[model samples]
Target: MPTRPLTCTQCQPKLLAYVHNQLADSDRRRVARHLNDCPVCYAAYLAQREVAQELAGTIPSIGLPDSLQLNRMWLAIQSDMNRPRTIPRPQLARMGVACLVFVLALLLPWSLDKQQVALAVPPPPRAPVVTASLNVTASPESGRRALPPTAAASSTEAVIPAAKTPDTPSNVQDTR
Candidate 1:
């Protein structure tokens, strides 16, 4: 894709990426070119570089591991180096057994639950039918006021007014 040239806004964010050499070849080149052309972005890049340098200088150095620990690590490394690339027969067998046991553990309960299933649960009894009279003296601006808030909240037979059809006379307001 033909990317648009980087503006100050775009270049500002990538200064850190440019400073750290984290930008891709094309992106790095673009950012480097932008830095040269734009003094403001170049200043930002310089600031980022300075901050990186300061951080590098102040980082507390870690002391090397002790000789015994180093020797143990070397021995472990050497042992791994001498070992065959493919899995050993005995270890592979043990791993296979472990995986089989895990699969059985997972599947056993599911299989048992399926075969020895409990009686099916019955659905709850249907809700009692409710009837209430609602006086909806509502306008478009006022909206519908079907009974007081307390009465409407408990009632199940709350009726929503249907939209006006084109056949309805404009003079006769729908009370439904």
Candidate 2:
């Protein structure tokens, strides 16, 4: 009995197996029949066969070298395989630098936040005693009282003295 005509899709998969003579007799016969009847399938089979033949011809057989040479090559390969691999010094240095930068990147914002917190919080309300001593004074001659000379000299006033202009002499009388 004659089999139904096989489509190109059905025949394409079996082509490689057929070219290599790897298919069962029944399947090979079916594919062979299809190739005989279908020009497109035949062309595809021919192309596949040509590629297989060319590949077989072009690829050199890899036979083992002489035993001594093969043994030496294997020993060299084995020694290479066994040797410990280490990162190059320059690459390790780069990695160390990268790690340092990454750690700094992670910590920078936190340090900045700590500084901001320090700035944001008003210094423990200057101890009332210190504030009172700084603000109130015994001198009544000048309606505006002044801190004791010692306290004034010891405070920030000592660090940054008020600038006196050249025209304004030190002996100038207070008009206030």
Which is the leading candidate under lDDT?
2
Query: Candidate 2: lDDT of 170?
Result: 60
Rate residue 59 of model 1 by lDDT.
Answer: 72
lDDT (Cα, tens digit) per residue for candidate 1, span 42-69: 8888889999899877873445457897
Q: Could you tell me the TM-score of candidate 2?
A: 0.35
TM-score of each: 0.35, 0.35
Which ten contiguous residues of candidate 1 have the minimum total lDDT?
114-123
**Stretches of candidate 2 above 4 Å error?**
62-176
Taking all chains together, the TM-score of candidate 1 against the true structure is 0.35
Which stretches of candidate 1 lie above 4 Å from their native place?
1-3, 60-176
Residue-wise C-alpha lDDT for candidate 2, range 53-111, written one tens digit per residue:
99878873545357888899999999999998775789789999999999999988766
